[model samples]
Target: MERIELVKSIEANAERILEDFTEILQYLRSEGSDRCDEVQNLLFATRRMVDLIDSALEIYHYLIRLKYLTADTQRSETAESRDRDKMLEEMFRELNSNLGV
Candidate 1:
């Protein structure tokens, strides 16, 4: 399969996973388990995953813009996405800091 096709597939899957996290959050809220701390940690991790996936999609688009991938793949090119990706990347350094792992 083509690289663009593969990237598009991945982007779609990432979006689905992100959407699932919303449902998970809602369910957890409804449950209001005693394990609130653990649930909060898991929610943070989920947010991080969503951010990472979003950044990945943006990076793939940047690759396309740089001609590393086909120019025809994505037509929009904005600095905002790159800035957002960089912010997400910066969050990685602090990701496990509070987790103590």
Candidate 2:
């Protein structure tokens, strides 16, 4: 898909995940019952969605580095850009280490 569409999809998915959390909070506050296990499952789902969002952000960064941010943007990435990429890689490494993934 096109970059803009992909970005929009990512944004929407993030929003949906947030909404799911909100719903979970609402349910817990109002109908706190034997649904604790369900709420826990929802939390796990939220975490997975967060991981997917991070992956999407990484893809977006790569696309931006590829000079696909705009049709007229022919500028080269700087050393800071590479540094940012390294930082993101390290972040993912730490995340995976924590998850044993």
- Over 4 Å off, model 2: 1-33, 68-101
Point out where model 1 deviates above 4 Å: 1-34, 68-101
lDDT values for all models: 0.64, 0.65
Per-residue lDDT of 1-101 in model 1, one digit per residue for the tens? Answer: 47766667667756766666665566555644468866775777677666667756765664555464455444335456777888987787578676665
Q: Model 2, 1-101: lDDT tens per residue?
A: 56667667667756765675675555445543557866776676667657666756765665674455554343345656778999999999999999999
Error of 2 at 70 (Å): 12
lDDT of 2: 0.65
Which candidate has the highest lDDT of all? 2
Residue 55 shift from truth in candidate 1, angstroms: 0.7
lDDT of 1 at 24: 56
Superposed Cα deviation of residue 43, candidate 2 (Å): 0.2
